[model samples]
Target: MVNFDDKRNFYRMLLNSEVKVTIIDDEINSEFVATCRDLSATGMAIEMSHPLEMGTRVKAKIESANASVQALDVKGKVVRIEEEATDLYLVGIAIDDMD
Candidate 1:
């Protein structure tokens, strides 16, 4: 028997907080709110009302409630999208640049 587990280098932190997402396409910019499900050093998972197209560029911001923890702001690309419900979608994004 073999044990299986997450293969990523960074462990994912479970987060149930609001995330602000900004889509960057050419000169058009659009913003929306989503719920962040998990976060890691390399990527994050978010749940939103609508699905984003694969390979779309976006910027995500997650503000920390605790003063000790710093807020996360990163530019990433949409890697995957899955429909969870009739109007709900789960989106995966790979972190490209962080601020």
Candidate 2:
């Protein structure tokens, strides 16, 4: 028997603070707003009103006024999605590139 587990290269920080997020999908030529749930060096989890399909390539810009961090603009792919409630979803994005 063989076992393999998904591992992360960076540490994740619990960030409950509200931050502005702009998600852009070039394939659909659409963009939307979302809120950040948590952040890490490699990725971040976000709460979005609209559900994005898994594997969607996106460009995102995250801006925060919190004293601990600075703004981030990156391109990533949607890796996972979980429904938290009606019309709300939790999205996991894997950071691919940074600007």
Clashes of each: 0, 0
Candidate 2: tens digits of C-alpha lDDT, residues 26-58:
545576677778777788788878788898877
lDDT of 2: 0.75
**Predictions in order: lDDT:** 0.92, 0.75
Clashing pairs in 2: none
Task: At residue 85, give the lDDT of candidate 1.
Answer: 98
Q: Clashing residue pairs, candidate 1? A: none
> Taking the tens digit of each residue's C-alpha lDDT, what string does model 1 give over 26-55?
576899999999988999999999999999
C-alpha TM-score for every candidate: 0.90, 0.74
